[model samples]
Target: MAPRNKEQEAEVLSWIFEVLGEKVPSGQYEDILKDGIVLCKLINKIAPGSVKKIQERGTNFQLMENVQRFQAAIKKYGVPEEEIFQTADLFERRNIPQVTLCLYCLGRITQKHPEYTGPGLGPKMADKNERTFTEEQLRAHEGELNLQMGFNKGASQSGHGGFGNSRHM
Candidate 1:
């Protein structure tokens, strides 16, 4: 496959976001991991089977095997292992930050591997909305927020648990 042109890349991103929008917490793109099956399918469409085995491994009887397969694929495919592990770790917790990290990892893959991206469509393009976050608006409570933003600071990835009454994997 050829690397996607801007138009083609945009379309693929749109489709992924559209699917994610419906499958996840409405407009919450970060919550993509909350519905791992759907996100895995979309990721597979772009990366070709990179995560298919992961969906099956998510449940009982093969957690370790599934973890290994998932780790291997991400490591081999150039995704940052830190982000991938963060996705699962956060996923088990079902918190907002985990969703954020998951989106980042998937976005990095599609952006980096344009050849594997989708071909362009005619004129029917993805929807668009615009918003701006200034330095202050985007980064309030700078000190505390920074400390709590990553995969580890807020929760332990060792088991499934959610913060405050948030969703639980």
Candidate 2:
């Protein structure tokens, strides 16, 4: 199916979050569980291949169609129950505490995995301020900046160089 346009997408997303925040409101519990599934799918879309990994590693999640091996593998790998249960807890439970934990863990997992490095989700950059700059690199960058701005103090003083709009008061 073709994707929804931006306005439609915004409305749907807004509805989901607003409904999820409700406490024992007019909705059915079963419907809420279905909403959780939709939310899980959206999260998977954001971090591709995550649903498969979650199935394989999310130990406490109980949807057992083709998940037998993952159940075994998760235990074998010694991944904690808490680590594995984010998706399931979000879908199956939908409690506020579980939802909070699931979102936190999902963010952590996506940040840790290399395949999730896309767009704004790229691997964290080390602070440039924390890194030591060699004098040669510093000089090169300075020269590049000067060239970028077409700046030359000596040429300017000789009155033969300018932005052509440099007015002296």
Kindly list the per-residue Cα lDDT of model 1 for residues 1-169, writing each as its tens digit: 1222444334434666564444223443323334455555555665677775654445533444444455566566776656665444434543444334434465556555657545322333244578888999777765564544574755665564657765555
**Which segments of candidate 2 are over 4 A away from where they belong?**
1-35, 46-79, 84-94, 118-169
What are the lDDT scores of the predictions, listed in order? 0.50, 0.42
Top candidate, metric TM-score: 1
Inter-residue clash pairs, candidate 1: none
Question: What's the residue-level lDDT of 99 in candidate 1?
Answer: 38
For residue 18, what is the lDDT in candidate 1?
64
TM-score of each: 0.40, 0.30
